[model samples]
Target chain A: MTIPVSITVNGRRYDREVEPRLLLVHFIRDVLGLTGTKVGCDTSQCGSCTILLDGVSAKACTCLAVQADGASVTTIEGLAGDSELHPLQESFWNKHGLQCGYCTPGMILASHELLRCNADPSAEEIRHGLEGNMCRCTGYQNIVRAVRDAAETMQGGTS
Target chain B: MFAPQFDYYRASSVAEAAALLEQHPDSKVLAGGHSLIPVLKLRLAAPSALIDIGRIDGIRGIREEAGRIVIGALTTHAEIAASATLQSGATALSEAAGMIGDPAVRNRGTIGGNVAHADPASDLPAVLRCLGAEFSIAGSSGTRTVDAADFFEGLMTTAVEEHEILTSISLPSGSGGQGSAYAKFSHPASRYAVIGAAASVAVADGVCSAASVALGGLVPAPVRAEAVEDALVGKALSAGAIADAARCVGDSLDDDEVLGDVYASAEYRSAVAHVWVGRALTAAAARCG
Candidate 1:
């Protein structure tokens, strides 16, 4: 059976009918064509499918599309404005946070959620916050640095 | 991997969710979906209906009431890890929550879902058991409470009936200089506990008045080391005494009961269990002192 789902993504509303078995990741990637949200491990082990669900980062792969009906979601593509990049996006690029860029979107989204609630997270706090997201390349040092750099910029500090 | 076809219902309230579950025998409650979705994707579980309770109100908060900490079933691990109340009153729980399946799983997974799933490898069950938490369940009949010890029946099994939905968990207020800690050796791949220990100690005048030790990922269900707890009472809160009591965890396990998988061996898990128990005991005792 198909269930009607109305979700707001990146400030735009999408109304559609979806299968109960369709994963939120699939819905975002295939239905909405927001392919920035990559699916790494279909299991919840990997953070590549991370997205902001109602302001909190969640694994899109584990969530059913029908579960997200009437909810608000934010993908990595939503992080940038028409002409400028989000501070975290800029920091990731400047700090060499991405090597393959496969995990970048998820990492960025997760970091966005972390920095939203915690503007000034300590190193340990940042590490703990990003534990759910995984990056095989760059050894995570640069990613941590990117988040720290972004946090500084968000606090109105010069980069 | 495509999940099997099923009817979906987004319940507006807990009562509606319970009614849906009661109406469909093959229906399953979808919380964080960290546990249920994987099984569905793997075709291990084929529920005919999925009642999504993620949208239900009043099932997602961490509150303190009447000297007890009440965590709603929908309270995510991130919420628990970030909760000041949990950090102050139930530090072990917060620590365990921080350690569950890395950051993404923690962000998406819920405490009630973890406890309801009743996986022996889950860190929350052992820690909550050590804290003497009570689980609240709601059904078509009514609501009922079950102690943590009684809530976990076996591997991947809980006291929750098929028609019942776990609503929340309540942890007792620590009193009389009580302190607690949780220690676990996680499998690097899955982050599930290879062997985990949660310890709570109540000290009075530099002596241990009472202690509870719970073990997980070493058996089919979380095990309370009653023998070790008995050995610690009246003993001076010292490192040596803690070590002795921790070592008694091995005696509580049967030769066939120790967990073994690709990540670890039975003997290794038993050894790690002893080490983790000692660490948890020492840390908890330090807090007590």
Candidate 2:
């Protein structure tokens, strides 16, 4: 069966006929060609499929595309403007938060959601915030640093 | 993983959802999709239709009415974790919500879906049982309330009827020095509880007037330690007395059958159960003080 779903993604409204079984992650990646949102684990264990739904970070893999109809979603690719990088992205690059970079986009998006609500999250708070995201390559130390750095930058710190 | 094909209906209201469920007998309600999607991907259970109730209005708030806190069915774990009301009134529920499958899961997973799925390893069921929460279910007929103790039947099962949708969970206002705590040993990979305990104690004049203990992850469903509660009543709120009461969990386990998995042995889970009960009791006692 096909269902008409109209969703707003990254300030763009898209209307599409989707299958009931279509996952929100696949819809964002395959239908919209926003491949930045990676699907690491089909299971909800890995946070590689994290995305912002209605301004909150959530696992996109477990959410049905139809469930997101009439809702606002933001993927990793939608974080920055055309020329500028999001603060979290810049922090990841400057802090060497990524080793393989497979988990970078999701990590940045998750961190973006955290910093939106909490501009100055402590190290423990950042760790707790990013607990859902798994980064096998960087060992999480740099990820934590990148989030803290991004929080500082977002708070208008010169450095 | 691709989910199996099924007819999808986005229900705008509780009545619409109930009607859809009634129309399609083999349909499932999609809330957070944390539990159902996995089953669909695994092909373990396939429903003919999915009634997505994620966008339903009036099912997403937390409010206090009279002397009870009413939590809407679609209230996400993230909301609960950040809720000051829950933190102050139902600290155990807030702690358990915080310990759910991390941030992303907490942000998406709804409390309604968790309790409806009735997973043995879920931290909320035990805490709800300990707190004596009540569930409000809506159907074509009308709304009905079910006590937490009577709601859960067995493994991954509940008393929720096929046509019924769980709308909200209600917890009575704490009065007269009531304290509660939930403690769990989680699986490293999935973060599901291997053995969890939720304890609530009503203290008066430095003595325990009433106590309730619910154990999870060790059995098919969350079970109350009635013997322990009975033993702890009127006992002095001391570490030694709490320890003695916690030992009654072993007695409770002897009467009930406990499920064992690769993560823990029956004996090991029983031991962990005692430790968790002790920890919960200690925390609850501290809250009383």
Model 1 alpha-carbon drift over 4 Å, by segment: A122-124
Clashing pairs in 1: A131-B103, A132-B103, A132-B104
lDDT string for model 2 (B1-289, tens) is 8867899887999999999999999999999998889889999888999888988878887999999999999999989988988887888998999999988888888999999999898999999999989999999999999999889998989989988999999998666598888999999998999988998898988789989899998888888999889889998888899888898888787534787777788878987687899899999888874
Q: How does candidate 1 score on lDDT? A: 0.89
**By TM-score, how accurate is candidate 1?**
0.96
Clashing pairs in 2: none
Error of 2 at A107 (Å): 0.5
Model 1 lDDT per residue over B1-289, tens place = 8988999887888899999998999899999888899889999999999888987879899988999999999999988988988876888999899888866677678998888888888899999888999999999889999998899998999999999999999998676488889998888878898888999999988789999999998888888998889889999978899888888987788878777987788888887677999999998887873
Worst 10 residues of 1 chain A by lDDT: A130-139
* CAPRI accuracy category, model 2: high
